[model samples]
Target chain A: MIGVGKVKQYSNVLDKPLSKGKQEVSLSAFAFLFSELVQYNQTQVDNIAELERRLEDAGYSVGARVLELLCHRDKGNRRETRLLGILSFVHSTVWKVLFGKVADSLEKGTEHEDEYMISEKELLVNRFISIPKDMGTFNCGAFVAGIVRGVLDSAGFPAVVTAHFVPIEGQQRPRTTILIKFAEEVLKREARLG
Target chain B: MAPAGPRSGDAIFASAERVNAELFTLTYGAIVRQLLTDLEEVEEVNKQLDQMGYNIGIRLVDEFLAKSNVSRCIDFKETAEVIAKVGFKMFLGVTASVTNWDADGTCCSIVLEDNPLVDFVELPDTCQGLYYCNVLSGVIRGALEMVSMKTEVTWARDMLRGDDAFELQVKLLKQVPEEYPYKDDE
Candidate 1:
């Protein structure tokens, strides 16, 4: 319905709808593209950390865009301002929109008030990827971590976000956990909000 | 209701396992942005994107063959139609139109009115020379090559560069003659 009454053609994308997120491509298409992203970055970097950083950086821009788009489209432009509010938004809203479900768990770090973790068993990006033994602890969850960071940073809750694999005693596949530590200013502001 | 016939692209797409378009859209954006930062040259990023697409295309053609059920012996004209109509629709959820053939039946233009790749994308001033959708061309080339049809695909128009539509000029270079079942040599 963009440029509804106007005669202008090639209506601006700003007027274009999000199509209610109904538009889709096959999951394999996304998986193949993502695998290419990983392979392409692997060729560009010398070390695992750098590779993860590159992937994270790629995901950050996505996170930023997701935050902006979802806020405008889903929230009617009202943003999350509190710590728990923003965290819940990321855990439930962002996760659901991007991955088709809420993250498996969101838990606060027992040792620190400012740190939290969002863990997913079989994270979507990691579902089809099996890191070679030689790659040494490289988790594709770094991309998801970057996404959470991007969302938090843009929504005024700056945090240090990193992805780690936490091994379970019985299971062969470890779960990926995104650990987020809020910045001092964010904590201060949250304290005041309370 | 599993009706078996010539399945429309929409039916195949609707039945396939799906994900949010925004996830795909934003992920691609992030890849482009990261490429621009790391490669530091728009041309290199475009080349890399094309190469990545080529790799993906060769692999995806198998899935395409299995799902679309396109006949293997179709002529180049029908191939272009399949690519523009079925191929694009099945993978990208958008249909492209074939146009402007030069009467040889070996070359034509594919015009896309809606491209998911360019959604919410505006080319920055620094990337004026970038073929933002170079990957699409590479995918066409690679996928065609897999079927033994060599092709040259280039951007004729790009909406990101202010063109009204996205167009790819596809030229069929050669079709390798398929010889099978161990030909007996003299």
Candidate 2:
């Protein structure tokens, strides 16, 4: 047991400032932790959709917090105003901060003006994951999609985000595409403001 | 008056590499909150966290072995020191102090003054029975079990739960020898 006297000697961590130092954690540790999260959520839900919903719910809170923190850290507290600006922020800044690299590409949907896609050749969260045959069409990237939804929703651009796995013939790491569909109201507001 | 050898364990930990503290804390918070909402039972949540930690520990030990160049320790005392100095520092960027060793040296406590996982956490009043940091104990138990050392680990105190300190008690029950069933055929 630590003595009360020792506790008094140490300063409270809350009093310290959050610095802008380049901090990095073990990827293996995070991969293992996330794997357990998927396993736990899998045991709780009956179907793949329910499991993805739960994973998204879990990532939602994180996305909200990350949005606030990242805005403060990288943008000087200025929130992105334009749709392309926010998508760029999510594609480049958010991806770099979270995964230590920029996403592969950001493309506009062919059929819809309000739809956008962000693709990653290899998602950090799914580095150590291997889906079983029983879990048909299950993509752990739903957590990342949930985060994207949370960030967009909180930033006043309400949208629905879904993750899809697209395997390349010769690539070792499979690609994940996050399809983001913005609400009609958002598009109307953007058009009026533009 | 200092012994002429390698520097002390704590000194080594002071120079360890660090990770983005927010990523560690936020992800852990998400996991805990999810478990609470899904299970709705403190005991079940605790069990689930431990089981998850056990699974993580089994895989984590392999990573630890691969990254660390340290050789095997001679005894349990040295083992505790290695775990505190190398394992915790390498993974979490924190050095736990090994203290309160029993007279027989079969049991001791690892005291963590700084825990990244609890940085943004506050145990809710409803989660009275939830052992928020029980995963640490489970990891210790699971990791030690892999090295042929059967041990029991429990949290003696947790700062997140309003305790004065964070202390994990590890007791070495016995050692089990490895058995190869195919050795006779070979």
Candidate 3:
């Protein structure tokens, strides 16, 4: 037996109450941890697509939990029922909780009725990340896209979320446009129900 | 060597940019929960966390140096002070107190009053042997290793495990000699 210690036990962590008071954490710690996450995934993948897929998979789990927690905390435990409502929830409430700011704009796709975009001037996840040239077309924002996908999927609005880098002329930082394309069934259901 | 003047932990915390603690605490909680479910073995989860923290530490040290702008430490005693005062404060927004130095002054313990990672954490009965916060030890070991200081870090006490305070003991093993990786000599 191990010596010189008291045997201590406590109830499960889930049993504890989540506090409503706002608390802050160090951003540098997160950036460094995220940088390491990206680096770790890079070593496991043979191509950029695979790496992005890994990151999305990682973020997917987080998205599912965050959706439940955020709804509980902010919406009086009420889940969003409408398409626009959920999108707005994601763009405003979810973004604010995650990034400390609202997204720049939410726009519908010009050519596609089922497509929408949420644009951010600078993604918090990519603040300190510098993608190397060797890893072509790899954006760490894929993780955020996965989170968006997870939230939408959990809320019964099935959609595909992808992050794209769209540079604006006047903006100092490259803008990230999260393209969300809903499933055909969703559009059909919205049309019939609304 | 005599201990240096006590540094203000609040000063370092006030100057850093902050993120919502929920974003960090919840994300980490999810990761740990996922690991517990996927790995099923508490020991394996601890190992994975340590490995991940090691990877984070090697890269995090560069950021720490750039932001803190502190030079090389004079001795192991000073190293412990910097880590307790600047390292923990800058990263976690909490300052640890350095205490319980060994007679040789090569080992010390850092006592942390608050830990963001374990804000809502509890050690389940099934995870009896698991060290939930082993990542902190790994980060300490990994970061110090990079600076040519081979040190062993272990949890002396954990608040999540019903301890009064979160304490980590760091023992200086030896200083690693510098080596030139790409030297060309016949």
DockQ of each: 0.50, 0.39, 0.41
Q: How do the residues A1-194 of candidate 2 rate in per-residue lDDT, one tens digit apiece?
A: 34333543224544545546254455556776788888888888899999999999888888887888788777899999888888999998877777777899999999999899999887777766888899888899999998889888888899999999988899876799999999999899899988
For model 2, what is the alpha-carbon lDDT of residue A23?
49
- lDDT (Cα, tens digit) per residue for candidate 3, span B38-123: 67999898887788788777877887777776767888998898888888888888767888898999988988766778765667
Q: State each model's C-alpha RMSD to the native.
A: 3.8, 4.0, 4.4
The list of candidate 2 runs beyond 4 A from truth reads: A1-16, A19-21, B1-19, B182-186
TM-score per candidate, chains pooled: 0.90, 0.87, 0.85
Q: Once model 3 is optimally superposed onto the true structure by TM-score, how far is the C-alpha of residue B135 displaced, in angstroms?
A: 2.6
**CA error at residue B99 for candidate 1, angstroms:** 2.1
Error of 3 at A47 (Å): 2.2
Model 3: per-residue Cα lDDT at residue B25 = 69
lDDT of 1 by residue, B121-161 (tens): 87878899899888888899999999898999999877778
Residue by residue across A143-181, what tens digits does model 1's lDDT show? 999999999999999999999999988999999999999
Pairs with steric clashes in candidate 1: none
TM-score of chain B of 3: 0.90
